[model samples]
Target: MSKEIKEKELIIIGGGPAGLTAAIYATRAKLNMLLLEDQILGGQVRNSYTIENYPGFKKVSGSELADLMQQQAEELGAEIDEFDMVERVDFSGDVKIVETNNYIYKTDTVIISTGATPRKLPIPNEEKFSGKGIHYCAVCDGAMYDGKIIGVVGGGNSALEEALFLTKFASKVYMIRRYDYFKGEKATIEEVMNHPKIEVLFNKDLVNVEGNNFMEKAIIKDSIDGTEEEMPMDAVFGFIGTEPKTDHFKGQIDLTDGKYIKTDESMRTNVKGVFAAGDVREKEFRQITTAVADGTIAALQAEKVIVERKKNQK
Candidate 1:
């Protein structure tokens, strides 16, 4: 931590579509803004192999979309600091304090777009073989499983897409789902079902991961029956769901079920000068377009409040 404190009109956390969009809007508003990301820019968007639903382009890769958004924000004069981990935050006072690994930021308003992270299984030995074999990101670790067999857990769009993506490297891919039917787009579900290398194991749940240094097999149980089977695999991937990255903001603002920040249509949380957008907030839809829309609304609303305060002060 640095003793030097930096001041800005607004501070945006996370570098996903939501955070980058907020930065773009704040820059156009001519307010001094700074964006901080704990790791590589784009957040979870980087894990997506391809994004077909986002507007404008009929089809685009996740990395490509993230790059375009990041480039646009930078060209519009948004200052961004990547790989800056936010250690803690204080939003109780009017002037919010955002403390990262390197610096402490004091700002009139804060936009929290930290987004969400992939959910992992609570099975046995999951911690021991986390990076060794059990992986969460297919794009990040799929190449290592070339010609090897792997299992994917979840039934959502992410799980479906990852199952197909892993087919490029893994000789055999098992898509294990707790439900009989998948909960992804119809087209994608059909694609995964029809893929030759991908096998769908419905009504199945992962019970444990077994291995010495690296994962070698998995214990899967039939959700309907009590029958369990051992399936040999080199690696396993999970895309079941996501948990909000709001640990730092906890107790500082209002949160809903599952610790998601609660905000109105304006994206304003319980805190007066603090707002949350994207997947971090409680909402039904957590798509890229929705996240961007949330970011836009939050930025505009925050700007309105700040401008009003300055005018009143004058």
Candidate 2:
């Protein structure tokens, strides 16, 4: 029911900006490499609308950027296998083994670039109404609610950013924060507070999402007084936070705070020949540019390891 595939010099898990960037660098280094992705090559970027901060592109669609990165990796001789979900990984041996649904791959070095997922709101009918009228990324689904009323949950930078972006489409935006104060950057808070289209509802928490087929209203409760209020809206967006997707690497590599994989300055994990990049790694800023930088550094370090090994063989 399974087959063993030939080993490669390097294998990159995940197909997002980090994984793709690593593949490009490894291919240029003449390291026979393969890239594995569970779904498409774009990763979370595909769920975004526009990316203006990635430098070299003033304004570009997220999907377009992902496609371009994929094309570049392919042109550089990186073999990409989409829809390949890795079941397990073995990094104890000299050759790392990556087991997927279709086949097993061996590699001299492995780079884990698996990213994080958005945190969900705990409320009734939340899962049932997902995509019906509720969303996680405002940039991705805000345009659909144009000229309508929408609610945004959380009080962080992402929440405020989403609220600001929603103003471009929604006639009115309601930001619900559980506490009296926000945890976002002061600048973002000031911008949101000054925005005419945005209204902040402090000391409130979402209790339920009400609708039959699409989101029609949200039930909010005052954290202090426990008073409930129903707000009618076309859609609800949540930007609470994100959790790393590092459960698979448990006990296999060192991690920080049981979330991000711990890596040295060179991006090498505690395990030799094993590296991590992107949001999965412990870093100060988790952004597209930083992810790309991590990938490049990991690939270059892997190349160095390969060169040293070849020399030892002689």
Best-performing candidate as measured by TM-score: 1
Error of 2 at 112 (Å): 0.3
lDDT values for all models: 0.91, 0.88
Per-candidate TM-scores read 0.97, 0.89
| Candidate 1 local lDDT, residue 56 | 95
Per-residue lDDT tens digits for candidate 1, residues 1-314, read 34679999999998899999999999999999999997888878887888989889898999999999999999999999988889999998888999888888999999999999888888878889999889999999999999999999999888899989999999999999988998889999999999999989989999998988899999999999879999998999988789999889878998887989999999999899888999999999999999999999999998987898799889
Model 1 TM-score, all chains together: 0.97
Candidate 2: minimum summed lDDT over ten consecutive residues — where?
43-52
Candidate 1 lDDT score relative to the true structure: 0.91
Give lDDT tens digits, candidate 2, residues 101-196: 889998889999998888888887888999977899876688899899999999887788789889999999999999999987787799999999
Best by lDDT: 1
